[model samples]
Target: MGALHVLSGGAARGLIARLREDFHQHTGRTIEARFGAVGLMRDRLLAGEACDVLILTQALIEELVVAGRVLPDSARALGLVRTGVAVKTGAPVPCLETPGAFKDALLAARAIYFADPAKTRAGTHLMQVFQRLGLMPELAPKLRFFNNGSAALQALSEAQEAEAQGVLVCTHMTEILATPGLQCAGVLPKSFELATIYTAAITARSEQPQAARALIEMLAAPEAVADRRADGFE
Candidate 1:
């Protein structure tokens, strides 16, 4: 059988990786997966990328279904994933119980890493948090942006080893939990919390619709709830 082509948001990477072998065993087909920012994944699908299955924000999946890019009845939500703060493993976890504390933590950090604001849900919300706190100018120099949360967290892990002081990252909670050498401090402060529902669907052009649906079922199966929760999916 032909491989199932998948384009997904970084938030689902860990869950998908956990299920890949099982899905392949059950279906006798391997998966070819590409994961990145939701916006970039949407753009890739719209740009004629070959995708049998697509995983992205629920709203984006709805939009694609409306646009006839994804089958209307094939979408199924994985779970809600929140925006969160993370630190390098073994580093001191910052207190972010309040907006003021969150702002202070950002100010105290030697650097801040996040996904591209223009291309990611968490990144955009994080920038808004900075704006609301009136620290945009002061934090601009310390900010570093990457293509997606996974990349930002990876860089954060590497940077913390070289720097003596604290570094902070804000991204999807799932991404934080999935990355090695990182520890999730907590979700964003209540006022700035962003919980996004991620969904998976079969593409309209899928050559293996049955396999695509099977993969989606595997990802959102009731039996996998504990695994999803462990990965920071609500």
Candidate 2:
């Protein structure tokens, strides 16, 4: 068997890290995981990058399977992740309870941070939300896009030191809740909430198919259930 290289989206990072750690301790297998946007990882895989396992949005996994970049029948549903807003721990929390209020919050912020709409599922849906709310044109100037949740959170942390009113950050709830120095501003209004289902599959380039399948099985096993459940995967 060989070391597993997992390419995953940021929302699944916490659960994946914990699972990988536990699996390693139980089996002495090394897992090297790189987490980022699903679209980013999908693009890299399509361009011939080698990965033993790919954990991404379920839709993306199906697309890669069709494109022959991942093995068919090797997919495992990981979790359902919802998009949420975040602010510096001690900063004022914006009201995102209703569509109109959420729109106002976005308009009132000096600067806002989110994942790349083109590269991440949460961001992509959020773009639609902005358009639906008719805030895109007005809020465009204040928007800053990052690669994924972690990058967006990091930018939000830096923005805390900027002007008097801290910047608003929004991304997957899982990532926002996992980090320190950030306050969970709550998920989007029901009318605007978007949940992305994540899945894992053995890559087409995997040299250790058994090992990869074993890991995938472990992910769905009872031992890893609690971590996955707590991380927003259902």
Candidate 3:
């Protein structure tokens, strides 16, 4: 059999990668996955990308269902993933117990890494938070934007080796934990927290609907709750 095509948001990359070998073993088919910003993934699907499965924010999945692009009955939510903060491994964890502390930490950092605000949920929310705190002008020069959370965190991890001082990153908790050389400090302070429900569905145009559904079942299986939590899903 040929490969199963999947387009997923960066938030679910860890879980999917963890389960890839098992899925291939069970189904005798490899998975071809594209992980990126949710908005970019949605745009890919809309632009006629060949996809057997689609994993994205719950609201986006529902919108696709109504748009007749995905199977309504095949949708299942993986879990909630929160936007969080991260620091380089072995670096001092910043105090983020309150909104004020969070602001202070950002101001103190030499640089701040994050995803593209125009193409990701976490990035968009973080932008709003910075604007709300009136730090946009002050922090603008320190911002380093990437295409997705995983990339931002990866850059943060690499930056640590080159610089003696540590930097800060804002992305989904999953991305923080999944990336090596990075430590998950914690979720963003309550006032600026963003918890998104990520859901998966078989695409309406899937060539292997059964395989796609099986992959979704594996991802959302109740028995995998602990694994999901370890992977930063709530």
Q: Pick the candidate with the highest lDDT.
A: 3
* Candidate 2 lDDT, 1-234, residue by residue in tens: 357888888887777776776667766788988888888888777777778889888998898888888998999887788888888878889998988889888988887888888777777888888899888889899888988878989766665354526588888888887776788888899999988888889998888778788888887676777878777676
Badly placed stretches (over 4 Å) of model 2 are: 158-164
Query: What stretches of model 1 exceed 4 Å from their correct place?
Result: none
Query: Per-residue CA lDDT of candidate 1, range 63-139, in tens?
Result: 99999999999999999999888998888899999988898999999889999888777788888889989999999
Question: What TM-score do all the candidates reach, one by one?
Answer: 0.96, 0.90, 0.97
Sort every candidate by lDDT, greatest first.
3, 1, 2
By TM-score, the better pick of 1 and 2 is 1
Model 2: ten consecutive residues of lowest lDDT: 157-166
TM-score-sorted candidate list, best first: 3, 1, 2
CA displacement after TM-score superposition, residue 162 of candidate 2 (Å): 4.8
lDDT of each: 0.90, 0.82, 0.91
Native-structure RMSD, model 2:
2.1
Clash count list over all predictions? 0, 0, 0
- Over the stretch 70-162, how does candidate 3's per-residue lDDT look in tens digits? 999999989999988998888888998899999999999888889989877788889999999999989999988999989988877787455
Q: Give the lowest summed-lDDT range of ten residues in model 3.
A: 157-166
Relative to the unseen true structure, what is the Cα RMSD of model 1?
Answer: 1.2
